[model samples]
Target: MRLLATAAVITLSSIAVAPALAQTMPVAPSVLPDGTLLDVTATGKTTRVPDLATIRAGVVTQAATAAAALSDNANRMSAVLSALKQAGIQPRDIATANVSLQPQYRYEDNKPPVITGYQATNNVSIRFRNIAKSGAILDALVAQGANQIDGPNLSLDQPDAALDEARVDAVKRAQARAQLYAKAAGLSVSRILTIAEGGEIAGPPPPMPVYRMAAAKAADTQVMPGESDVTVTITVRFLLK
Candidate 1:
């Protein structure tokens, strides 16, 4: 009787440990003896017109003292802002980007660096909803005392529509690639098993600085609205039969 009881306890312990062992096991994919997986690449691109313009303009002033320099910059920037408003730019479209004041230094042989004067700078960022007026607005700003002008970055205001089109193009491209691979391998494509997306190429260009204002060069600036390009790419995995 004692032997029978020990055997029963041993049986129950083995059953409990079996569950733990099964939980610790790793899963492996099942495949046919001669089957193999293949990786393929596809590329797609689409372009659309850009609808917005972004530019940076501001004033730089020099004076005998820091306070004087700052005051001068403030006065000039005020005029520039007023001019932009008169040119039909909404108040919300103009933003102050940077305000800096630094002391000017003079270096001479056998002499320690000395404070010569002070320079102040004020920069404003402007976003033009209408690309047509980009050049005119820049010209007006220059006339109002904006000595530094930075890029008129042309870009799409709403990119969702363009992205949707690009996605469709990417799928078509992937399908073509899968077909080619299937034909080459003597296999037929059954269906797409997985699809992965990559970054879009339709972003705005890097900021451009116009440097000297256009008004300083021409009485009326002429702006050309260059075309913008947008692109997209996708990766697709297809199951073969």
Candidate 2:
């Protein structure tokens, strides 16, 4: 009984000391100083020639019945896929963007709408690594029964390097502005307190001119991949002394 009473007293003492130990531990400071802080946002932009192209090509077929329309669309799409493969586009680079079969309605004056026929559409998005040959590939797709073609959205395959360059520029600009502000206030920039990225990394710009191809034969298309601009924005907080 005496030994049990001693053990119980020791456990109680340890429990009482735990909170004091925690209180004695040091905590890292969240803010740099209790001084004035300046927050600045800066954007940096860089232009680069696009090395990649994304093409959207598809086939649309109309028939009296949904099955016939779908069948015609499938056959045309198959030919388009074959042409893509022949143009050196890998299977992984091609993806189905959309597929739909809808009934065509004919509206008459003061009369109820009537279903005339069904139209089927199948769209595929293709990523072309070789930008130079993209035009030729598009021409081939048209030859292979691709009635609808949109875009050759030009972009960079690896945008990280460009974005990193923009980030460096942004930081430099922010620091310059901070120094200017501190000097104007008769103070010096002590140190950077924190940095946060803001705004979206700009995406590939819109295609320059939109083109619509009919069922008629088209000559070799000429595609001009112009330069694209990449922009980055950052917010920086600095302590003034």
Candidate 3:
């Protein structure tokens, strides 16, 4: 489990914060017979290729009236959904992210803004487990009246295991550093007194623009999710004899 609280307290505050279900007590060294205390902070990271992709596909339409704009958006969005299903996307991986209707206005030099037409947008967020086929699916979506394509944000499908591995690496590095310090001080390492961890830092790549079919009709869209780094940092207290 990830350590939410940095200081390990046996008892939590009377008014504990939500989401942090449990508190871990810091270990206290029972014996301190002639020893020096040392604190070591170390960070470890691991790189892995992202296994999942996220894309926002949407239909945008403008008409004279709100009802007409909405109606047109709904019809085109329905076709987009059908195209997604036809491309082997699962129902669970597809979700409606946004639906909005706003008035398009034209601004004049010396007069109040004039309402031109109503613009309707319906967007769906799709998770592609198969990164290889994500590009093709995005192209298909564009062909089916989907004009607004926002992202191809690549990320890991499962990060828990990778994070755990990083934690273990961090602990090992801390131990190694502690040993080095003990040797430098002409003392042997004894035991650990406490261990605290900062928040994990794992971030995906920034969003990339996926071109619509009109501008790039010559070729199929391609997605290249390079790699991401998962890092864990830990501070450990050591006793040296």
Candidate 4:
């Protein structure tokens, strides 16, 4: 009875070990009889109209002390915000993007730099839903003590439809490439193994013709909003049989 119990224990251990060894084996890709490798890539693109404008404007102030510099920046920014609001900008449309106060430094030969004064900055982001009013709003802000301005990044408010269109185009391109490969190999396209898409919208700033604004009768700062383009690219892989 002792011998039979020992034999049964050995058999059970062997059975458990066999399954683990099998599970450790690596999976290999399927191979065709003719040794033909299947690979294909596709690309697609689409364009979209822009519907929104984002502008970055700010007030920069420098004074003998940090408190004085900050106070000056605050007063100038207040005027700028008021101008934007009077121009029909909503509260949500205006946001304080950044506020920074740093000490100014003056370096002398062979001596450590000394803090001369403090420079304070307050930047605001403005979204112009009404594109037509963008130029006037910018002018008003500048007139109200806003010294720094950057961007007016034009873009579409919603880009879902454009992306969908680009996706379909990409898949179609992948299918066409797969079909070409399969035809050459005397086989046929079977299924899509994988599909991936990545793209970004590019919006360069509109050329701002500088204006002296010496008088109200000065020629208005002419702004021409040319067409904006939305670009999309995708990669797709198809299986051939």
Return the top candidate by lDDT: 3
Local accuracy by lDDT, each model = 0.65, 0.73, 0.74, 0.65
Q: Write the per-residue lDDT of candidate 1 for residues 78-162, one digit (tens) a residue.
A: 9999999888899788888899999999999999999999999999889898876777788788888999988776666676676
* lDDT score, candidate 1, position 76: 91
| Model with the higher lDDT, candidate 1 or 2 | 2
- Report the C-alpha displacement of residue 193, candidate 3, in angstroms: 1.8
TM-score of each: 0.76, 0.79, 0.77, 0.75
Regions of model 1 farther than 4 Å from truth: 1-36, 202-219
- What is the lDDT, from 0 to 100, of the residue 93 in candidate 4? 85
lDDT of 3 by residue, 1-241 (tens): 1111122211111110112223343655475445677777677666778788888889999999999999999999999999999999999999999999999999989999999999999999999999888888888888889999877777677767776777798788888887877786677778977877754653544446443455645667878766666676677877777
Q: Which model, 2 or 3, shows the larger TM-score?
A: 2
TM-score order, best first, reads: 2, 3, 1, 4
lDDT of 4: 0.65
TM-score of structure candidate 4: 0.75
Worst lDDT 10-window in candidate 4: 6-15
Report the candidate with higher TM-score, 3 versus 4: 3
Task: Residues 1-241, candidate 2: write the lDDT tens digits.
Answer: 0000000000000000001111121232574366666777777666777777887999999999999999999999999999998888999999999999999999999999999999999999999888878888888888899999888777677877877777798788888888887787787888986767654354544455334465765455767766666666676777777
The TM-score that candidate 3 achieves is 0.77
